[model samples]
Target: MNASDQNALVIEGGNQLKGEITPQGAKNEALQILCAVLLTEEKVTIHNIPDIRDVNQLISLLEDLGVEIHKIGDNSYAFQAKEIDITYLQSEEYKAKASSLRGSIMTLGPLLARYKYAKIPKPGGDKIGRRRLDTHFLGFEKLGAKFNYNSDHKYFEIDAHDLRGTYILLDEPSVTGTANVIMAAVLAKGTTTLYNAACEPYIQQLCRMLTSMGAKITGAGSNLLKIEGVEQLSGTTHTMLPDMIEIGSFIGLAAMTQSEITIKNARIDELGLIPDIFKRLGIQMEFRNDDIFIPEQEHYEIDRFIDGSILTVADGPWPLFTPDLLSIVLVVATQARGTVLIHQKMFESRLFFVDKLIDMGAQIILCDPHRANVIGLDRQIPLRGIKMTSPDIRAGVALLIAALSAKGTSTIYNAEQIDRGYQYIDKRLQALGANISRI
Candidate 1:
């Protein structure tokens, strides 16, 4: 479990996996909700939390800030931020941990709301492209906060004597930015209106949890939100929905490997456009109550438009297809009976990993930095596995899926990138009868 370990995954391909699996809690939601715990001094109990590297590191950072953490179980915890010491944020040890994950930037909002001042190191995460923090800082400034960047220390600092809520429109529907601004505005002094806000399930969950903690928030699952700031917030218990990205990855894995698998307790309602998008790629899935069942198939064909044009799968903001699942879709399309285009509009560099797929004997044309054309082989020629390194969380899972359906053994280096978002992925895959070993 050491973060510094050079881990790798050795996967044996061509296995017919079967059984039922349940996804862990949503990692994206847990990051936002965990940061929101800093808004109150009372103990907040959170259930269905994912035990992943990024979440664990964020919890450690919270502990450094003097938050009292109690482990209720493997998937539940109680967090109390009564005696937080803000000074620790400037220390080298704190900086090292905070700069390792992008979730650490979320701490700025709560700290500014509760203590009137905050310091944060430049956050780090998957280097897909330019993930600008302009929306977050602009929203903070709109709420009457002063922002400054320290060039020497490579950090950001903000101070607000009295945060006054006002109407602000974000340039883009940035999920983390919206969450940060909403958390700060909840305790501000006036009515705050947020337009063009992200309506992802993660943001909606964070808003609902805040509402339970005595914050007045309206428009839970919409692009517009209204928050009337209160003087204080109390603690509340919240449970995260299942990780939709993980569920999508499982579906791709099942289809690629010709496996019959059921994803239990998938929170089907929250998964907007995911299942339908897979259906567009000719993936057959049945909704058995709350679970999704994918049966083994010899072949699944991609659906074209009514006019017989090639279907292109692109990513965008909420209510549209998420960028996280595009990688999985690309991998699944490799074995389908038709051609499709995968467009990753959000991050330019994400499609670079397709080179690895092409090297594995798949037919992929790197259209550009944002698009790739995948021509399905109809499983006529199975993919030959080769050694490669994982680039990011989504692509890591995509590579794993490709490896599972490949014709030979494959070894993936930089397995920690996969571990960052997935919880015990190797063990879980092994439970489903996949031959994957971690070393």
Candidate 2:
């Protein structure tokens, strides 16, 4: 659903939202963790699972694979892959379901590791940029898996008869790619040393959970990871961290709306560089235990480089600001007091949403597909709401933020894109006094 989808968000803009909002479980981490459940036959109890579209879609795909799924709570599930239907991998139904969301790509590692065969249609998600599966297939090939792609059917398959681990130096530090390789390596016969791995908190959480399931893994939060393959794994209960991307988005929303909002259970210790990066935008936030207190501000200023140069906010590997939050940052800068360069180095098409913001009266120069120069209005002229369409998940949320701060009402089409990542976003924002409704 790109723009013609009937799932739209009608937002009455210029409302100063208040109260506390708790973020849902981390969506990125949940995808990898849920796939990891396939590695062990025991019951894997996972709490803090978000009830979002993509995750739910993946859960349905797991059900198609004959994994025993039991919902223990509103946001908790116990999964047992004891009787996986391997034959389902060849069915047309499996192809369509697996192609619906990009998260299905993670299942390949576990299925190939345990069953020695796995096939999936080319997974789909946001069309922000080109995301290749080379790292995943190349890593698998290094671990004794024969990779094949049937271009006619738009699906790929892997055959792993005898899995043995070896040294792997990834060409790029991709989080999901790293996760797929790690999951496959955990059940290999020999030691697997993975260098240039993605050290995001999501990957670290996966490592911890895999360790609890009897996998021998070291370097949970570093680029260099070593895993001694274990014969089998036992299930264990694990809790997911709050979505840091949501936390960052909430902070941006509070500043954009000038609302006094508190983000509960943000797990600040785990939010590395997020708070400080927002501080770069001059958005003041207070940390009270695990909660983040965002005070209403009439005007916020953007900080410049120490050499009196324009501050350039760029995305890179972890510990650096994330590319996922760059859209939110771009929106937050629209109403800020100064000019800053938003360099979205990761995905070329990610910065394309600025055109919608420009139509809504934002002073943004799309320097190229990769960079944008946002000269803020500083709230002197409030943004005028207009009808727009959400292109992807992060951009959808970013446009929502822009609409919340704009004057008059705004209608956003294709809101299902937003629902893919954020859990009940309209309801949660409504709880915080936002004038938004999903239609």
Candidate 3:
């Protein structure tokens, strides 16, 4: 973290928080949708946008590109890409700003599709694992773009005089890769067939938003997408979905602290398999209309498989449980009655935070980089608070959950990591009766 973002949270543990809280706009969706503004010169208004660090940084990058920006209302902004400042994009200032966050990499798609040229520094994000860009350039190459990696300066460059779309199969179902290719394909010369694409809800929202902006796209919610290139796109209004990962985090928080918490307007329909996966972990929740009410429970037991085997909580592609919430699931299982094997397939380093949890008295066996065997304490022994450092956004919040449920007091360094994805989390949790304060 930079000097501006350096901070800490001192939480008084063993507090049973109560009351209702609403989640912010989906962070992942907002990142992609904001970059989509580059596809048109007309005014684009996005509503319910989260005021998180990553999203805000991307918005600033848009302004640096000469996009007209105005905050029309609370959590809403209007963007107009009337003229892009190509001069500044090649400057040192732009390089520093764009290299700070990973979302800046998505800008290449719109720039290449519209201006026939694009370049970006190698993006930086969580130090979880290797996130590749081959899927992006390979798809762009299939669309008649010339590609080259300037490894000397750690950046990528691509150009095309005329983008002619063609059939391309992604080696992996990458969300951002699918998004980059989608924006590039929407303005190409011919129809592009993308198979084995990621079908995350956020990706669906991107396609739907582009369709609203005069792009012809089919099969949004499935892995197969066909996009017929249009001459240009116009502006449109878009509203983002609630952050399902936050909703899951809140559910874990309620269970861990034994609190009665109501999460309002969660857009429960779009949270495919999240609640069910938490249900298997013995978290009791009631769906009331659009809200989820998790009541306080003295005890909840993990459910075994039908064949009488221990439950294995794992993450897979979309329509399955999302990988983002696996850390939250790992933390919640620490207090449950039964054992579970957490199989995190997406990243290798997310489970490294288990050492922090172990310091607080949770019995976890780090089987390998990709899996962990968690022996739930069943509240037989209350977790004791200790000092630890926040690793990344997801793991940071997982540690916060641990601190909130632990006994006595805990001090967590690098609270800024938590702030990257969540908006004013400390203040929101305070309203819910959590004894947390930033320093």
Clashing residue pairs in candidate 1 are none
Poorly placed runs, candidate 3 (over 4 Å): 1-6
Candidate 3 residues 231-283, lDDT tens each? 99999999999999999999999999999999999999999999999999999
Across 1-439, the per-residue lDDT of candidate 2 in tens digits comes to 4345789999999999999999999999999999999999999999999999999999999998999999999999999999999999989888888998899999999998889889999999998999888999999999999988999988798999888999999989999999999999999999999999999999999999999999999998999999999899999999999999999999999999999999999999999999998999999999999999999899999999999899899999997899999999999999999999999999989998888999999999999999999998999989989999899999999999999999999999999999999999999999989999987
* Residue 18 Cα positional deviation in candidate 1, in Å, after optimal superposition: 0.3
In model 2, what are the clashing residue pairs, if there are any?
Answer: none
Provide TM-scores for the models: 0.98, 0.99, 0.98
lDDT of each: 0.94, 0.94, 0.93
Candidate 1 lDDT, tens digit per residue, 290-360? 99999998899999989999999999999999999999999999999999999999999998998889988
List clash counts for every candidate, in order: 0, 0, 0
Decreasing lDDT order of the candidates? 2, 1, 3
Reference-based lDDT, residue 27, model 1: 92
> Measured by TM-score, how close is model 1 to the native structure?
0.98
Q: Give the worst 10-residue stretch by lDDT in candidate 2.
A: 1-10
> RMSD in angstroms, candidate 1?
1.5
